[model samples]
Target: MNNTLKVSKYLFRDFKNALLIFYGIILAIAVLMAALFLNVISQESGNASFGGFGFSAFIFLFVSGLNCFKANFKFLQANNISRKRFYYANIITLLSISAFMALIDASMTKVLKLIMPYEDIVEQLYKNDLFFSSFIWSFALFTLAASAGWCITMLYYKCDKLMKTIISFAPVLLVILLVMLNNVTEGALGISIIKSLTVVLGFTNNNPYTAALSFLVATAGVLGLCYLLIRRIAIKD
Candidate 1:
Protein backbone atom coordinates (compact mmCIF):
# COMPACT_ATOMS: atom_id res chain seq x y z
CA MET A 1 0.00 0.00 0.00
CA ASN A 2 2.85 2.38 0.72
CA ASN A 3 4.46 1.51 -2.59
CA THR A 4 1.17 2.13 -4.32
CA LEU A 5 0.91 5.53 -2.66
CA LYS A 6 4.45 6.39 -3.72
CA VAL A 7 3.75 5.30 -7.26
CA SER A 8 0.49 7.23 -7.35
CA LYS A 9 2.27 10.29 -6.05
CA TYR A 10 4.87 9.90 -8.75
CA LEU A 11 2.20 9.56 -11.42
CA PHE A 12 0.42 12.67 -10.17
CA ARG A 13 3.69 14.60 -9.97
CA ASP A 14 4.64 13.52 -13.48
CA PHE A 15 1.22 14.58 -14.80
CA LYS A 16 1.38 18.08 -13.33
CA ASN A 17 3.27 19.75 -16.17
CA ALA A 18 1.40 17.82 -18.82
CA LEU A 19 -1.88 18.82 -17.25
CA LEU A 20 -0.83 22.44 -17.21
CA ILE A 21 0.19 22.26 -20.83
CA PHE A 22 -3.07 20.61 -21.78
CA TYR A 23 -5.12 23.27 -19.96
CA GLY A 24 -2.96 25.97 -21.47
CA ILE A 25 -3.94 24.83 -24.91
CA ILE A 26 -7.54 24.62 -23.83
CA LEU A 27 -7.37 28.11 -22.41
CA ALA A 28 -6.04 29.49 -25.64
CA ILE A 29 -8.74 27.77 -27.64
CA ALA A 30 -11.42 28.95 -25.27
CA VAL A 31 -10.17 32.51 -25.46
CA LEU A 32 -10.14 32.47 -29.23
CA MET A 33 -13.59 30.95 -29.43
CA ALA A 34 -14.97 33.37 -26.87
CA ALA A 35 -13.57 36.28 -28.80
CA LEU A 36 -15.06 35.00 -32.01
CA PHE A 37 -18.40 34.47 -30.35
CA LEU A 38 -18.32 37.90 -28.81
CA ASN A 39 -17.74 39.43 -32.18
CA VAL A 40 -20.62 37.48 -33.64
CA ILE A 41 -22.83 38.41 -30.75
CA SER A 42 -22.08 42.06 -31.35
CA GLN A 43 -23.68 41.77 -34.79
CA GLU A 44 -26.47 39.40 -33.73
CA SER A 45 -29.72 40.01 -31.89
CA GLY A 46 -30.19 37.08 -29.47
CA ASN A 47 -28.21 34.32 -27.76
CA ALA A 48 -25.53 32.42 -29.66
CA SER A 49 -24.56 28.94 -28.54
CA PHE A 50 -21.00 27.70 -28.34
CA GLY A 51 -20.16 24.04 -28.08
CA GLY A 52 -17.33 21.46 -28.45
CA PHE A 53 -15.15 22.96 -25.72
CA GLY A 54 -15.93 20.18 -23.28
CA PHE A 55 -15.01 17.64 -25.94
CA SER A 56 -11.46 18.99 -26.10
CA ALA A 57 -11.01 18.06 -22.45
CA PHE A 58 -12.10 14.52 -23.21
CA ILE A 59 -9.72 14.25 -26.15
CA PHE A 60 -6.82 15.51 -24.08
CA LEU A 61 -7.38 13.00 -21.30
CA PHE A 62 -7.96 10.14 -23.77
CA VAL A 63 -4.73 10.88 -25.61
CA SER A 64 -2.96 11.29 -22.30
CA GLY A 65 -4.15 7.83 -21.29
CA LEU A 66 -2.92 6.40 -24.59
CA ASN A 67 0.58 7.71 -23.92
CA CYS A 68 0.69 7.29 -20.13
CA PHE A 69 1.45 3.57 -19.87
CA LYS A 70 4.53 2.61 -21.85
CA ALA A 71 7.14 5.05 -20.58
CA ASN A 72 5.93 4.93 -17.01
CA PHE A 73 5.61 1.17 -17.09
CA LYS A 74 9.17 0.85 -18.37
CA PHE A 75 10.52 3.25 -15.79
CA LEU A 76 8.70 1.63 -12.89
CA GLN A 77 9.67 -1.88 -14.00
CA ALA A 78 13.31 -0.85 -14.23
CA ASN A 79 13.02 0.50 -10.68
CA ASN A 80 11.61 -2.86 -9.51
CA ILE A 81 8.04 -1.67 -9.04
CA SER A 82 5.56 -4.50 -9.32
CA ARG A 83 2.95 -4.39 -12.10
CA LYS A 84 0.14 -4.60 -9.56
CA ARG A 85 1.38 -1.50 -7.78
CA PHE A 86 1.83 0.34 -11.02
CA TYR A 87 -1.69 -0.50 -12.11
CA TYR A 88 -3.14 0.51 -8.78
CA ALA A 89 -1.25 3.76 -8.94
CA ASN A 90 -2.64 4.41 -12.39
CA ILE A 91 -6.19 3.77 -11.20
CA ILE A 92 -5.73 6.14 -8.32
CA THR A 93 -4.10 8.81 -10.44
CA LEU A 94 -6.66 8.56 -13.22
CA LEU A 95 -9.63 8.77 -10.89
CA SER A 96 -8.18 11.77 -9.09
CA ILE A 97 -7.26 13.49 -12.34
CA SER A 98 -10.65 12.80 -13.85
CA ALA A 99 -12.46 14.19 -10.84
CA PHE A 100 -10.29 17.29 -10.76
CA MET A 101 -10.77 17.96 -14.43
CA ALA A 102 -14.47 17.34 -14.17
CA LEU A 103 -14.78 19.89 -11.42
CA ILE A 104 -12.81 22.42 -13.45
CA ASP A 105 -14.87 21.78 -16.54
CA ALA A 106 -18.17 21.95 -14.73
CA SER A 107 -17.20 25.24 -13.16
CA MET A 108 -15.99 26.56 -16.48
CA THR A 109 -19.24 25.61 -18.12
CA LYS A 110 -21.26 27.39 -15.46
CA VAL A 111 -19.11 30.49 -15.76
CA LEU A 112 -19.25 30.47 -19.55
CA LYS A 113 -22.99 30.10 -19.53
CA LEU A 114 -23.29 33.04 -17.20
CA ILE A 115 -21.01 35.22 -19.34
CA MET A 116 -22.29 34.01 -22.69
CA PRO A 117 -24.71 31.65 -24.37
CA TYR A 118 -22.46 28.68 -23.85
CA GLU A 119 -23.85 25.17 -23.68
CA ASP A 120 -21.90 21.97 -23.84
CA ILE A 121 -23.23 18.92 -25.66
CA VAL A 122 -24.31 17.47 -22.37
CA GLU A 123 -26.25 20.55 -21.40
CA GLN A 124 -27.90 20.64 -24.78
CA LEU A 125 -28.87 16.98 -24.52
CA TYR A 126 -29.63 16.65 -20.85
CA LYS A 127 -31.26 20.10 -20.65
CA ASN A 128 -31.47 21.70 -17.21
CA ASP A 129 -29.53 19.17 -15.15
CA LEU A 130 -28.29 20.11 -11.70
CA PHE A 131 -24.67 21.16 -11.26
CA PHE A 132 -23.72 18.09 -9.22
CA SER A 133 -25.26 15.70 -11.72
CA SER A 134 -23.48 17.45 -14.55
CA PHE A 135 -20.20 17.16 -12.71
CA ILE A 136 -20.72 13.46 -12.10
CA TRP A 137 -21.60 12.91 -15.74
CA SER A 138 -18.53 14.75 -16.90
CA PHE A 139 -16.33 12.78 -14.53
CA ALA A 140 -17.75 9.52 -15.76
CA LEU A 141 -17.23 10.50 -19.41
CA PHE A 142 -13.64 11.62 -18.86
CA THR A 143 -12.82 8.43 -16.99
CA LEU A 144 -14.44 6.35 -19.70
CA ALA A 145 -12.42 8.04 -22.41
CA ALA A 146 -9.20 7.53 -20.50
CA SER A 147 -10.01 3.94 -19.69
CA ALA A 148 -10.82 3.23 -23.33
CA GLY A 149 -7.52 4.69 -24.44
CA TRP A 150 -5.66 2.68 -21.83
CA CYS A 151 -7.46 -0.48 -22.89
CA ILE A 152 -6.57 0.07 -26.53
CA THR A 153 -2.97 0.86 -25.70
CA MET A 154 -2.67 -2.23 -23.52
CA LEU A 155 -4.16 -4.37 -26.26
CA TYR A 156 -1.67 -3.03 -28.81
CA TYR A 157 1.17 -3.47 -26.36
CA LYS A 158 0.23 -7.11 -25.75
CA CYS A 159 -0.34 -8.06 -29.40
CA ASP A 160 2.18 -8.96 -32.09
CA LYS A 161 2.27 -7.28 -35.52
CA LEU A 162 -0.42 -9.49 -37.07
CA MET A 163 -2.65 -9.24 -34.04
CA LYS A 164 -2.12 -5.51 -33.97
CA THR A 165 -3.24 -5.28 -37.58
CA ILE A 166 -6.36 -7.22 -36.73
CA ILE A 167 -6.99 -5.09 -33.70
CA SER A 168 -6.52 -1.94 -35.76
CA PHE A 169 -9.18 -3.11 -38.16
CA ALA A 170 -11.43 -4.51 -35.46
CA PRO A 171 -13.63 -1.40 -35.32
CA VAL A 172 -14.23 -1.41 -39.04
CA LEU A 173 -14.85 -5.13 -38.97
CA LEU A 174 -17.28 -4.72 -36.13
CA VAL A 175 -19.14 -2.05 -38.07
CA ILE A 176 -19.32 -4.23 -41.14
CA LEU A 177 -20.52 -7.16 -39.10
CA LEU A 178 -23.10 -5.01 -37.42
CA VAL A 179 -24.32 -3.75 -40.78
CA MET A 180 -24.70 -7.30 -42.06
CA LEU A 181 -26.52 -8.33 -38.96
CA ASN A 182 -28.81 -5.35 -39.21
CA ASN A 183 -29.57 -6.11 -42.84
CA VAL A 184 -30.20 -9.76 -42.06
CA THR A 185 -32.61 -8.77 -39.37
CA GLU A 186 -34.17 -6.04 -41.50
CA GLY A 187 -32.91 -3.22 -39.26
CA ALA A 188 -34.27 -4.82 -36.11
CA LEU A 189 -30.77 -5.30 -34.75
CA GLY A 190 -29.84 -1.67 -35.31
CA ILE A 191 -33.12 -0.48 -33.85
CA SER A 192 -32.74 -2.73 -30.87
CA ILE A 193 -29.19 -1.54 -30.26
CA ILE A 194 -30.23 2.07 -30.52
CA LYS A 195 -33.12 1.54 -28.19
CA SER A 196 -30.92 -0.20 -25.70
CA LEU A 197 -28.38 2.61 -25.88
CA THR A 198 -31.08 5.22 -25.46
CA VAL A 199 -32.37 3.47 -22.36
CA VAL A 200 -28.95 2.86 -20.84
CA LEU A 201 -27.81 6.37 -21.69
CA GLY A 202 -31.02 7.84 -20.26
CA PHE A 203 -31.93 9.58 -23.48
CA THR A 204 -35.43 8.17 -23.23
CA ASN A 205 -35.85 9.51 -19.73
CA ASN A 206 -33.58 12.55 -20.09
CA ASN A 207 -31.53 11.69 -17.03
CA PRO A 208 -27.85 12.49 -16.74
CA TYR A 209 -27.49 10.29 -13.67
CA THR A 210 -28.39 7.18 -15.64
CA ALA A 211 -25.94 8.08 -18.35
CA ALA A 212 -23.28 8.70 -15.74
CA LEU A 213 -23.86 5.27 -14.28
CA SER A 214 -23.59 3.71 -17.74
CA PHE A 215 -20.34 5.55 -18.41
CA LEU A 216 -18.93 4.38 -15.09
CA VAL A 217 -19.91 0.81 -15.85
CA ALA A 218 -18.34 1.01 -19.28
CA THR A 219 -15.19 2.48 -17.79
CA ALA A 220 -14.98 -0.38 -15.32
CA GLY A 221 -15.39 -2.93 -18.10
CA VAL A 222 -12.64 -1.31 -20.15
CA LEU A 223 -10.30 -1.12 -17.20
CA GLY A 224 -10.93 -4.76 -16.45
CA LEU A 225 -9.87 -5.66 -19.98
CA CYS A 226 -6.84 -3.42 -19.59
CA TYR A 227 -5.76 -5.31 -16.48
CA LEU A 228 -6.18 -8.63 -18.24
CA LEU A 229 -3.94 -7.45 -21.05
CA ILE A 230 -1.41 -5.74 -18.84
CA ARG A 231 -0.81 -8.51 -16.30
CA ARG A 232 1.24 -10.74 -18.59
CA ILE A 233 2.32 -8.20 -21.17
CA ALA A 234 5.87 -8.68 -22.46
CA ILE A 235 7.99 -5.56 -22.19
CA LYS A 236 9.28 -4.34 -25.51
CA ASP A 237 12.34 -2.20 -26.05
Candidate 2:
Protein backbone atom coordinates (compact mmCIF):
# COMPACT_ATOMS: atom_id res chain seq x y z
CA MET A 1 0.00 0.00 0.00
CA ASN A 2 1.05 3.60 -0.59
CA ASN A 3 2.64 5.37 2.38
CA THR A 4 0.10 8.21 2.28
CA LEU A 5 -2.73 5.71 2.09
CA LYS A 6 -1.29 3.79 5.00
CA VAL A 7 -1.12 6.89 7.10
CA SER A 8 -4.61 7.93 6.10
CA LYS A 9 -5.99 4.52 7.03
CA TYR A 10 -4.35 4.70 10.42
CA LEU A 11 -5.83 8.13 11.07
CA PHE A 12 -9.28 6.99 10.03
CA ARG A 13 -9.05 4.03 12.35
CA ASP A 14 -7.88 6.23 15.19
CA PHE A 15 -10.78 8.63 14.80
CA LYS A 16 -13.50 6.05 14.20
CA ASN A 17 -14.29 5.47 17.86
CA ALA A 18 -14.01 9.15 18.72
CA LEU A 19 -16.51 10.05 16.05
CA LEU A 20 -18.94 7.38 17.15
CA ILE A 21 -18.71 8.36 20.79
CA PHE A 22 -19.18 12.02 19.93
CA TYR A 23 -22.31 11.39 17.92
CA GLY A 24 -23.60 9.08 20.61
CA ILE A 25 -23.28 11.89 23.12
CA ILE A 26 -24.87 14.28 20.70
CA LEU A 27 -27.76 11.90 20.23
CA ALA A 28 -28.30 11.70 23.96
CA ILE A 29 -28.24 15.46 24.23
CA ALA A 30 -30.69 15.78 21.38
CA VAL A 31 -33.06 13.33 22.98
CA LEU A 32 -32.90 15.11 26.33
CA MET A 33 -33.32 18.50 24.72
CA ALA A 34 -36.22 17.29 22.65
CA ALA A 35 -38.02 16.07 25.74
CA LEU A 36 -37.36 19.36 27.47
CA PHE A 37 -38.72 21.18 24.48
CA LEU A 38 -41.79 19.03 24.51
CA ASN A 39 -42.57 19.95 28.10
CA VAL A 40 -41.86 23.64 27.47
CA ILE A 41 -44.02 23.69 24.39
CA SER A 42 -46.85 22.06 26.28
CA GLN A 43 -46.75 24.78 28.91
CA GLU A 44 -45.96 27.77 26.66
CA SER A 45 -48.55 29.73 24.71
CA GLY A 46 -46.26 30.66 21.81
CA ASN A 47 -43.92 28.68 19.58
CA ALA A 48 -40.45 27.80 20.86
CA SER A 49 -37.29 27.35 18.82
CA PHE A 50 -34.04 25.53 19.47
CA GLY A 51 -30.92 25.57 17.34
CA GLY A 52 -27.14 25.87 17.04
CA PHE A 53 -26.44 22.17 17.46
CA GLY A 54 -24.37 22.34 14.33
CA PHE A 55 -21.98 24.63 16.13
CA SER A 56 -21.33 21.83 18.61
CA ALA A 57 -20.03 19.66 15.79
CA PHE A 58 -17.85 22.55 14.65
CA ILE A 59 -16.37 22.96 18.12
CA PHE A 60 -15.81 19.22 18.38
CA LEU A 61 -13.90 19.10 15.11
CA PHE A 62 -11.77 22.11 16.04
CA VAL A 63 -10.76 20.47 19.31
CA SER A 64 -10.20 17.25 17.44
CA GLY A 65 -7.74 19.06 15.17
CA LEU A 66 -5.95 20.51 18.17
CA ASN A 67 -5.50 17.09 19.75
CA CYS A 68 -4.80 15.09 16.60
CA PHE A 69 -1.29 16.26 15.76
CA LYS A 70 1.02 15.68 18.70
CA ALA A 71 0.44 12.02 19.59
CA ASN A 72 -0.18 11.00 16.00
CA PHE A 73 2.93 12.75 14.83
CA LYS A 74 4.97 11.05 17.54
CA PHE A 75 3.58 7.63 16.70
CA LEU A 76 4.05 8.08 12.97
CA GLN A 77 7.56 9.37 13.51
CA ALA A 78 8.40 6.36 15.65
CA ASN A 79 7.22 4.18 12.80
CA ASN A 80 9.54 6.03 10.36
CA ILE A 81 6.76 7.71 8.37
CA SER A 82 7.81 10.81 6.43
CA ARG A 83 6.49 14.12 7.67
CA LYS A 84 5.21 14.88 4.17
CA ARG A 85 3.08 11.76 4.19
CA PHE A 86 1.92 12.41 7.72
CA TYR A 87 0.77 15.88 6.78
CA TYR A 88 -0.96 14.60 3.67
CA ALA A 89 -2.81 11.99 5.71
CA ASN A 90 -3.93 14.64 8.19
CA ILE A 91 -5.26 16.86 5.41
CA ILE A 92 -7.21 13.98 3.97
CA THR A 93 -8.57 12.95 7.34
CA LEU A 94 -9.62 16.48 8.27
CA LEU A 95 -11.44 16.99 5.01
CA SER A 96 -13.11 13.61 5.16
CA ILE A 97 -14.29 13.98 8.73
CA SER A 98 -15.49 17.52 8.15
CA ALA A 99 -17.58 16.46 5.19
CA PHE A 100 -18.93 13.45 7.05
CA MET A 101 -20.01 15.51 10.03
CA ALA A 102 -21.47 18.16 7.77
CA LEU A 103 -23.67 15.57 6.13
CA ILE A 104 -24.88 14.39 9.52
CA ASP A 105 -25.54 17.95 10.66
CA ALA A 106 -27.49 18.79 7.54
CA SER A 107 -29.59 15.69 7.80
CA MET A 108 -30.19 16.24 11.48
CA THR A 109 -31.26 19.80 10.81
CA LYS A 110 -33.92 18.62 8.42
CA VAL A 111 -35.12 15.88 10.72
CA LEU A 112 -35.23 18.09 13.78
CA LYS A 113 -36.96 20.87 11.94
CA LEU A 114 -39.66 18.41 11.02
CA ILE A 115 -40.10 17.34 14.65
CA MET A 116 -39.59 20.73 16.24
CA PRO A 117 -38.51 24.30 15.57
CA TYR A 118 -34.84 23.61 14.90
CA GLU A 119 -32.83 26.10 12.90
CA ASP A 120 -29.25 25.45 11.89
CA ILE A 121 -26.50 28.04 11.47
CA VAL A 122 -26.88 27.95 7.72
CA GLU A 123 -30.55 28.72 7.98
CA GLN A 124 -29.87 31.45 10.51
CA LEU A 125 -27.15 33.03 8.38
CA TYR A 126 -28.50 32.58 4.87
CA LYS A 127 -32.20 32.28 5.76
CA ASN A 128 -32.55 29.43 3.32
CA ASP A 129 -33.94 25.97 4.02
CA LEU A 130 -32.64 24.17 0.98
CA PHE A 131 -30.97 20.92 2.00
CA PHE A 132 -28.24 21.14 -0.62
CA SER A 133 -27.36 24.68 0.38
CA SER A 134 -27.36 23.70 4.05
CA PHE A 135 -25.02 20.78 3.40
CA ILE A 136 -22.63 22.86 1.34
CA TRP A 137 -22.52 25.65 3.90
CA SER A 138 -22.05 23.22 6.77
CA PHE A 139 -19.28 21.44 4.90
CA ALA A 140 -17.45 24.69 4.23
CA LEU A 141 -17.76 25.95 7.80
CA PHE A 142 -16.69 22.63 9.32
CA THR A 143 -13.72 22.29 7.01
CA LEU A 144 -12.62 25.80 7.90
CA ALA A 145 -12.91 25.05 11.62
CA ALA A 146 -10.91 21.85 11.30
CA SER A 147 -8.23 23.43 9.16
CA ALA A 148 -7.93 26.45 11.46
CA GLY A 149 -7.59 24.14 14.44
CA TRP A 150 -4.92 22.10 12.67
CA CYS A 151 -3.00 25.25 11.82
CA ILE A 152 -3.11 26.40 15.44
CA THR A 153 -1.84 23.05 16.75
CA MET A 154 0.88 22.97 14.13
CA LEU A 155 2.04 26.41 15.30
CA TYR A 156 1.96 25.30 18.91
CA TYR A 157 3.97 22.22 18.04
CA LYS A 158 6.64 24.23 16.24
CA CYS A 159 6.95 26.89 18.96
CA ASP A 160 9.01 26.85 22.13
CA LYS A 161 7.59 27.20 25.64
CA LEU A 162 7.61 31.01 25.62
CA MET A 163 6.28 31.12 22.08
CA LYS A 164 3.49 28.72 23.06
CA THR A 165 2.51 30.99 25.95
CA ILE A 166 2.53 33.99 23.64
CA ILE A 167 0.47 32.18 21.04
CA SER A 168 -2.03 31.15 23.69
CA PHE A 169 -2.61 34.73 24.82
CA ALA A 170 -2.30 36.23 21.35
CA PRO A 171 -5.91 35.63 20.32
CA VAL A 172 -7.37 37.22 23.43
CA LEU A 173 -5.02 40.20 23.17
CA LEU A 174 -5.85 40.68 19.51
CA VAL A 175 -9.54 40.68 20.33
CA ILE A 176 -9.02 43.25 23.05
CA LEU A 177 -6.97 45.45 20.73
CA LEU A 178 -9.55 45.16 17.99
CA VAL A 179 -12.30 46.10 20.43
CA MET A 180 -10.33 49.14 21.65
CA LEU A 181 -9.67 50.23 18.10
CA ASN A 182 -13.31 49.84 17.19
CA ASN A 183 -14.37 51.92 20.18
CA VAL A 184 -11.90 54.66 19.29
CA THR A 185 -13.25 54.67 15.76
CA GLU A 186 -16.83 54.82 17.04
CA GLY A 187 -17.52 51.28 15.75
CA ALA A 188 -16.54 52.23 12.22
CA LEU A 189 -13.91 49.50 12.08
CA GLY A 190 -16.31 46.91 13.46
CA ILE A 191 -19.03 47.94 11.07
CA SER A 192 -16.63 47.92 8.14
CA ILE A 193 -15.35 44.48 9.00
CA ILE A 194 -18.88 43.18 9.36
CA LYS A 195 -19.80 44.68 6.02
CA SER A 196 -16.82 43.09 4.37
CA LEU A 197 -17.63 39.73 5.90
CA THR A 198 -21.27 40.00 4.86
CA VAL A 199 -20.20 40.73 1.30
CA VAL A 200 -17.67 37.92 1.22
CA LEU A 201 -20.24 35.57 2.72
CA GLY A 202 -22.84 36.71 0.19
CA PHE A 203 -25.34 37.48 2.90
CA THR A 204 -26.76 40.43 1.00
CA ASN A 205 -27.54 38.16 -1.93
CA ASN A 206 -28.46 35.09 0.16
CA ASN A 207 -25.92 33.13 -1.85
CA PRO A 208 -24.47 30.35 0.27
CA TYR A 209 -22.44 28.97 -2.60
CA THR A 210 -20.37 32.12 -2.64
CA ALA A 211 -19.81 31.92 1.10
CA ALA A 212 -18.84 28.27 0.74
CA LEU A 213 -16.27 29.14 -1.86
CA SER A 214 -14.80 31.86 0.35
CA PHE A 215 -14.57 29.42 3.26
CA LEU A 216 -12.83 26.85 1.05
CA VAL A 217 -10.31 29.47 -0.09
CA ALA A 218 -9.63 30.37 3.53
CA THR A 219 -9.18 26.70 4.43
CA ALA A 220 -6.72 26.25 1.57
CA GLY A 221 -4.67 29.18 2.82
CA VAL A 222 -4.70 27.82 6.37
CA LEU A 223 -3.64 24.35 5.23
CA GLY A 224 -0.86 25.93 3.14
CA LEU A 225 0.49 27.60 6.27
CA CYS A 226 0.22 24.32 8.11
CA TYR A 227 2.35 22.70 5.43
CA LEU A 228 5.12 25.28 5.88
CA LEU A 229 5.07 24.82 9.65
CA ILE A 230 4.79 21.05 9.59
CA ARG A 231 7.77 20.66 7.26
CA ARG A 232 10.00 22.34 9.87
CA ILE A 233 8.51 20.62 12.91
CA ALA A 234 10.76 18.11 14.71
CA ILE A 235 9.49 15.44 17.07
CA LYS A 236 9.37 16.75 20.61
CA ASP A 237 8.87 15.09 24.01
Query: By TM-score, who's the top model here?
Result: 1
Clashing pairs in 2: none
For candidate 1, the lDDT comes to: 0.86
TM-score of each: 0.94, 0.92
Candidate 1's clash total is 0
Which pairs clash inside model 1? none
lDDT of 2: 0.89
lDDT of each: 0.86, 0.89
Model 1 per-residue lDDT tens digits across residues 9-83: 988887899899988987887787778777777478756677776688799789978988888889898998988
Predicted structure 1, TM vs. truth: 0.94
Clashes of each: 0, 0
Worst 10 residues of 2 by lDDT: 39-48
